[model samples]
Structures are given as structure tokens and as C-alpha cells.
Target: MKQAADPAKERYALMEKIQMVDFALVELTLYLDTHPQDTQAIQQFNQLAVESRDLKSAYEQRFGPLRQYGASFSGYPWNWGDSPWPWQL
Candidate 1:
């Protein structure tokens, strides 16, 4: 029989991927600021942005909002408190 996946581990892994993609996006933003004519970098940045957004949405649907103060939507009963906080992960 196959074993079940661990929720905490899965959550942590997804969060790590989002962080990596977001970090790359930020770096690309800074680079593009200097090299505005680089078409390849621009394309890469756009791709990463979409990937980051999708990852965050998937994570939020499974766990909770990755941000607060209207940055992310919370489910009924306020699920922000339902999952482990970033620091706790």
C-alpha cells in the first residue's frame, strides 16, 4: 500500500518553491531595471511571476493565506489560524 503524504512537509516544500521563484523574480526585476533591452530576461521574469502566483494560490487553497492585511483571501471562519505560521514551518 502507498503511504499518505505529510501535510506539514508538503506545505513546507511548496512554500520553499514559492520563495525560490519569488526571489528569482525580484532579482530579475532588479536586473531589468538596468538592462531594459534584454528581451530574454523580461520573458523569464514574466514566466516566473505567473509560476509564483500559481504556487501561492495552490498553497493557500491547501493551507491558508500566505499574507495578511488584504493581501490574500481567507476562507470561512478565518483559516489564517488553521495552519502553521511561516516561522513555525
Candidate 2:
């Protein structure tokens, strides 16, 4: 039988992916600022934005909110205080 995946490892991997995508989106934004007519870069930026949203949603669903101050939803009992805060990773 296959072994179950480690939640910590999975969370790290997903966070890394989201970070990379977000970084790329930022670079694309800067590029687009200078090259506003670049349709290809615009498309890429839009695609990555959607991917980032989806990845963050998945992470929050499994691992808890990635932000506070009304930026992310919290379930009952206010789970933001749960252990293993983002910096602990």
C-alpha cells in the first residue's frame, strides 16, 4: 500500500509553488508596465494570477488562513491561533 503524504511537506511544497508563481507575476507586472502593448505578457500575468488564487485557496482550505485582518476566512473557534504558524515552517 502507498504511504500517506506528510502534511508539512505538502504544505511547504504548495507554499513554494505559490511563492514562485507570485514572484513571476510581479516581474511580469513590472515588465508590462514598461511594455504595455505586450499581449503575451498580459496573458501570462492573467494566467498566473488565477493559478495563485487557486493555490492560496487550496492552502487555506487544508492548512488555515494565510492572512488575517479580514484578508482570509476562518472557521469556527477562530483557528488562527493554531500551532505551526507560517514562520514556524
Candidate 3:
């Protein structure tokens, strides 16, 4: 893939979808934990949780880490220095 591929749009879309899935998972988890007899709901919740994990991993791999983790990256003096905020897309 070319470095010129504009990932901004794709990145934003994925972020939105992931958030929705996360919210659903949280709501369903709380409900199902208290109501374990709902096998169908539990199954759907499990499937969605897996999808969410995969989406998060793919996003992080394509972009940078969602959160800075230790010194896993090399420091640079590129900008800010006066740079732009991430959402300036």
C-alpha cells in the first residue's frame, strides 16, 4: 500500500463503530451476568466482544498506539514544536 493512502476517513469510521460495539458489550455484559439463562444474548455478546478486540488491534496496528505504552517508541523532535491536534483531520 502506498503511504499516500489517506487513512483519516477510514480511521474515523472505525473509531465510531468500535465505540458503539463497546457500549453494547458493556450493557449486555451487565445484563447477562445477572441473567445467565439468556443463552442467545450471551452468545451475541461473546461474538461482539471478539469483534471489538479485533477491531481495536487492527486500528492500533494501522495507526499508532491508542495510548502511550512505556518507551516502546523512539522519541523525535518533529513538531509541536507547533503541530496539529489529531482531530484536525
Which candidate gets the maximum lDDT versus the true structure? 2
Which candidate order results from sorting by TM-score in descending order?
1, 2, 3
For model 1, residues 1-89, the per-residue Cα lDDT tens digits are: 99999987899899899989999999999999999999999999999989998999998889888888998998998787765785576
Q: Specify the poorest-scoring 10-residue window by lDDT in model 1.
A: 80-89
Q: In candidate 2, what are the lDDT values of residues 1-89, reduced to their tens digit?
A: 99999998999999889889999999999999999999999999999999999998999999998878998899887999887776666
lDDT of 3 by residue, 15-43 (tens): 77778898999999899889989989989
Q: State the C-alpha lDDT per candidate.
A: 0.89, 0.91, 0.68
lDDT of 3 at 20: 86
RMSD of each: 1.3, 1.3, 5.3
lDDT of 3: 0.68
The pairs that clash in candidate 2 are: none
- Give the residue spans of candidate 3 off by over 4 A: 1-5, 67-89
In candidate 1, which residue pairs clash?
none
